[model samples]
Target: MSLRFSLMGPVRAWRDEEEVGLGPRQQRAVLAALLLNNGIRLSNEQLIGMVWDEPTPSALMALRTYVYKIRKTLPELHLKSMDGGYTVRAEIVDDCRGEPLEGLRSAYFDAQRVRLGDYRLKVREDCLERELDVLELQKHVAAHPLRERPRALLMRALYLEGRQGEALDHFHRARALLNEELGLEPGPELREVHARILNGDLSAPRRPEQLLPDLVDFTGRAEEIAQALRTLPGTVGITGMRGSGKTALATRIGHLVKGRFPDGQIFVRGRDVAGELLRAVGVENPVGDRAALWREKARGKRFLVVVDDVQDAATVRDLATPGSAMILTSVRRMDELPGVTWLKTAGLAEREARDFFRKVLGPARVDAEPEQAGVLLERLSRLPGPIRVIGGRLSSRPHWTIGMVLQQMEREGKLAGVIPSDCVAMLAPLIAAEERLSDPERHMLMCFARQDAEVIDSQRAADLSGADPGEIEMVLESLAGVHLIEPLVLGRYRLPRFVRFYFRLRTPALTG
Candidate 1:
């Protein structure tokens, strides 16, 4: 029988048009909140606040009580605890239209819903909730930042993914996190385990990085790609979070627009564009003035040069010559550069991100667990870097299911190094730049990292940092100007998830 839940009416639950007992009003409200905001994670704090308009210290206890009652009422409901929060399955379709004026799921839940549908949402047949039952749990993990289980899980998960380097790096972070948060070294339990892993005593299966993830289904960036193509013969700066595919986009453009350039195309990281271009044109070390020589050689030629991960404006300043067209990719827009077209890259649409998973993991396998795949996408924030990394890891081990990967990720809290080095390197330069800000500005930025809310206005920032309300606006704008923070509508500001994590890592130091 089809299940129906209503928020517009008296918060009722029904099976095949017949009302199912949701226990009581409070219990029904909990179910209503969960199913209504499916796919989006709600922290325990948030769920407690949502279930009851005002909550006391016992709110969590009350929330759990209702969760149990609701589950007893309907065993089919899919509620999951993931990524330090809770998520509901999108399959629980929404028919309720209350104060928000909703026609589609996208209209109501913009933060969570990536694809649109009629009245019904989608879930998988095997996308069961709570795969790890309380009885099956041998040990209990707590919320302390230095908890051994969380760090161990992420390290183990990374090692299993054949990323031993990342697993080792995450251990250092956990150690530092413990010292920073609790002012103590890792407990004896954690230290002994670390010793074994460090000594190569832990069993780890390593795979070479030979498997190049092919992207047959490139998506969600057609307009940006076209903009890159159209603004040729000049520097087109592609700015995005680490995994938003700036390098991949540049590579794709180089392939597509190769014919336009008669001489050749060269990609470089630093001021070494001169050498790369010289090598591409098959010219062995010119006599004098490499910059002038490059310009003279490219004088009339429509050569293409792509500079990836440009940290500062000076890198482009050196490559700024008339001969060849330049394509620059970086975390910042590099807006100071003359004649530069800025293309800000955002994460792929939910549907596009899911399609990307299928492309890597194979359609049949992905379709076998579409709902879990969707959750996995949400967990990875739909970034190409993590998506590719996790997808390729699964490809290496075909026996691994989507549910298992997701469970591990959820347990790890973004998994310190589950993805490639791209995640680690993306913020290094920006973080260096952030160091130049005043103490107040640095503290204000740290406030964003510490909080869960993304959109913070001047008033909120002022309150968080205990600074003047007037000063908060100017500071936020300054951060935005440097591309360290993002400005949203209505004077709100947001820090990207990774950016927030980076600052949070430095938060202990920032305050100290």
Candidate 2:
């Protein structure tokens, strides 16, 4: 028996050079999540959280069915049934960086220069300042001997810690040194940051991308967020659809409890996941056993690795050394990651989504036309990604009212609206899902497109598609795995409203 598993792109498997039949999209998500962390056992609760974005009454039963289907399809795969969860057998080929529950690849890294802001984060404190860090900032200034950004940062750090006299004194010294050296004034941004510090705006916000944004009106996921904090020093997986605030939640938790991780907080994105972590901890150009070297270096260091926009779980698993805590955010469900807690982010509740709108548009703006606003939220699918994009557009234009926006939504239709209700953005994921389907599965989905009902069972599907009942059952299951169709209890299939609209929009000629 030969078996190959890919966690990259969409979760798929090959046995004997032929693609093995997989279950529904959620099930595929489960499979992908499992394959990524091949040796780790995931409990039923963990699997349920990663697979389903929302709480389902039948999640436990559904998980059982999905596992059984996977076993039946890939009998050669070593899918183990643990005491409380499940595990799958597959070798982790380290290469590629697709998001969670996708594909795998080995990590290669390159060195980078650490900025003052980044360095400062490694040794930051809230109420007090570390004297050695102050000296290190000074040492960087001495090395530059002419730059003002580092000097300005040093001043700000001192000022926040109630060293007003020393901060001003340092600023004056930096100003004099600059005049004597390059005959230049500090850059506008540096000057502004210094000014803000001088004005006692210590509580002023930093860049939105600076570690974590201040989520003052942070709306949902109280339980999951809390559990994530509690499970620190261990791995916590945050998986959701794109723009579901997976990264935001991870950043927030990283910042809130950073006191526990005194070593530092490493926020990684772009190339070289392992390389980036090594740089943060003072290692350069590792030549062997990257995992072992990383474990040695990170030993006794309480750094928090917040891996945003994760493309593959192999990167996370490889980076999860015996040392250090990790939090992974992905747009796909992740499974089989050993010793990792799972948190699946869904669309906000009605109340939270509405409240989020109020905060974004201001209470007066949304409250004035509450009914229309409520309807508008539903149209946006209550996903944070859409809400923030559209809300940001509206907030920037004060003259435009919520009612005006709603009218525009009706006129252009939610999916057709360019900025706020972008059909292309909403359809991208569905398109990707469709691309992963087999020829028969694609044909079956085409048949689904021709139907009127939003749901169809295996028997009804065969009737409408003119395919054999047994064949249709397998086809529907395949389509459901990529989320083109939803698999229900007793072999029923349901489609989301947006999905229904998209199918109807597809020309019959194209489907035929």
Candidate 3:
């Protein structure tokens, strides 16, 4: 004889069309627990934990009694004890016609009721998807305004019915309700639906391939590239002063490893990193509670996300995924971000910078004026940004010699004019970094810059700034943390030449 069990309503069982007596409520709870894990073993402790909120000293004996009663009542259940646990072989039915475990009072049973209730609603949603029952979905959303799946289904139904405006309005209301109630915005699913209705794009979300074009004149960083590639499917944080070619190095690595991640390769450069990442992976206009949806999209996928010009650790935490890799470029080291392989970039080596100029200006042009080129490279501090700008200017004006270019740069008293129009934003990162400093920090930096020495120790810093030597050391360490200054042997520090120049130009009074 077969047994039919129902927990969707009051716990009951029928054996071959005859209703079986299931004894007391606690006994019924044991029977329900067994039925839930029909083919699995349930230890005495496991059974008690699932059936009672607080088990008494006699609960173990009580549980054993319940098992005996259940076996005697339903002989066909084949309940047997083995391996210090009980296992039952019985068929369980999911009948969702009524409330699950109705009339049950134990806390354990109440939690199961909620879980099964959610399962029932999910089944109903599966049915409604085929039926397109807008009214039913609306009621579900009204009752559980926080449930994103039901609301998304409603949005889709409304869009299919040509009620675009209504769908949009419903989304706005859902957003407002979620924000007001839970202090969260809607997740990716709802936002995607809203974007689709607004753009009339009912197609599947697009997988973004937004990596910026790799530098054609990309040069050097062979070791850095190898190190980054070795850390595949993990995070690599590249930190340096502004215009140190951090972005270029990260971009080069991104392109080199693009073939490994079949899911996609995404690039994020602006303030809206989370939203940009979501949209790149097909969640358009990702709103409230984006982290969960972003993780969902990233799970079980091999992708590459290159976040450029990051200012903080929190910006890329959600971008980390189990099966993907990330390359983050920032002006400051993100020490707070966990599990990152850090590489600090600096001005290119003389050999690499010369090779870069050769690639941009042609070997003949660079070779024709090797001496002048060396001098120009020295004057520019061999930083790739300025070198590239000068290379472009000379490339465009072939009549201009490296000597003439150097004279022009000298006459201008700054390389600001030689910088191409497009590359002018290079200073923005430095300015922003400077603006983030505290008054004390800025004042200390200016005082250090005003000193005549090329390198300063804590004593020099304290004497110049009139602060304690210990306190000045801490400030120097803080400055080094942001890559504004470089720490050397014997407690000495040297600010980068370009950074010194920048501070001198910005604060003329600090200059000699």
Candidate 4:
């Protein structure tokens, strides 16, 4: 009997005018395996092994189900079970010429449609991260030579994964093998994939800087940070003193390698926590609406987000993309966030300090001679903010040279305030603010803001706040929202220098 089959889009089997149905996955697997092999008697074990790829006690029963389905549909065809093997005894002939192997082919190919979509949508990502462990099993099964469709599907997935090199390599190898062994080129669909990879285009958007961070003038420290970032394998935390250039360095580091992120950078100030709290309570816009802004910035593509004066670890984690790079700045230590790379920014070394002073001071001297540069450098920590402020002051009053400015600074005691606006009046405002605290919460803010080091200890802070540890936790969290303080590590807090100073110097009248 010449059996007729139509196997495009959906698989259909027929003999003369009668139709046959293959009902279930295992049944389809059995029939398709037999069709692929053709005329061969497959032992029960071989059929079960091919169909399920694993041990099953009901394997024979499942095979019986497939055989029964096929038998019921093609009652005229003879199927014999003998010698513990199954054989299709039907004499299927050519349609006077080219026979129809189309039905079984369609069934087998249709099985792959959803699998291909799942591999593309549910598994692939451009972050070079293995996010879906469940797909790992699929990857192994799809790599086999006999599974051309699945293999091609997997390759297309990898191509969309931003691993252009690996994807292209697999595609080429598959193409070569398909042509050499099967005498067939990859279908037009896969051919289009080859074209796309060659053109460096894939459905998954590329992350421009996965391998390295963009380097900037940071010199030794910046390069060291970048190298640490590449090797460290996770997020980085940056800490420094006021005018120590933490924000500047963090911003520079992010900018240097912004292209690497491809996701753009996020900048949020530490002091904006109040705004964040107010927004959270629906009282006012979150400080600069940074949380909402961050969400917006992070909406579509990946990003390298920097939260300056990072007081909120929860906020940081919320804003962070799982595999993306982020640089956070704090006046305090942030040891709480996991997988954070911490880089400390101290004031410049003496030589760099001298250069900074001179950069602002210039070649010619005003009142004091050029040699008096050393005197000014020793008095100042060589911090850029202070150097610029002092230089700008002296340079403005051309009548005074370095010596005279130093002399007047020494006499008037205005040298401290002479620091740039960004880093002016450090300790006094903090101390006076401590005096004005009516509640332990306010005092806690004062203590955290005046942290001598770059980070604060929150648990110890609870002890200092004189509130229950839980209350301290709540207040600390609240202060963090207002950007008054930031978490350097769990239970520790760091205060921004400018705010600390502002509190100490400005009396209630000035502050109110």
Candidate 1 residue lDDT tens string, 1-512: 33545544345566544677766666665665677675678888877766555578887888877776766777756566676567765233233233221222222243323332222221110011112222222122233344565456556555555667877786788788878887887777567656766777665322111112335666667788766755665678888755677788877766665654544566677656566666555556766666667676665445678888877786456656553568888876776788798888766888889888888778998999989988777655677766777787788888989998766544443443233253344344445566577777777767777674566688878877777877888888877765556778757877666455556656655566
Preferred candidate (TM-score higher): 2 or 4: 2
- Model 1 CA RMSD to the hidden true structure, in angstroms: 30.9
How accurate locally is residue 505 in candidate 4, as Cα lDDT from 0 to 100?
30
The TM-scores of all predictions, comma-separated, are 0.49, 0.52, 0.57, 0.40
lDDT of each: 0.62, 0.64, 0.77, 0.54
Provide the lDDT at 199 for model 2. Answer: 75
lDDT of 4 by residue, 415-460 (tens): 2223334234433323343443446556664454345334656678
For residue 436, model 4's alpha carbon misses the true position, in angstroms, by 11
For every model shown, the clashing-pair count is 1, 20, 1, 42
Query: Which of candidates 2 and 3 reaches a greater lDDT?
Result: 3
lDDT of 2 by residue, 434-458 (tens): 5566777766655665564677778
When sorted by lDDT, best at the front, the candidate numbers are: 3, 2, 1, 4
Off by over 4 Å in 2: 1-210, 396-407, 410-490, 498-512
- Compared with the true structure, what per-residue lDDT tens digits does model 3 show for residues 1-512? 33657777878987645789899998998988887787799888898988888889999999999999998998877889988789886544444467888766777778788998987776566555545678988888888888888888888888888888888989999999999999999999889888888889865334567788999999889888877765666799998877678989998988877865666789888777888888886777887878778888777566799999887678777668875789998887877888899998887899999999999888999999999999888756677877787788788898989999777645543433233344344345556678788766777776655452457687877887788888888888888888777889757987766565455444544332
Candidate 4 TM-score versus the reference: 0.40
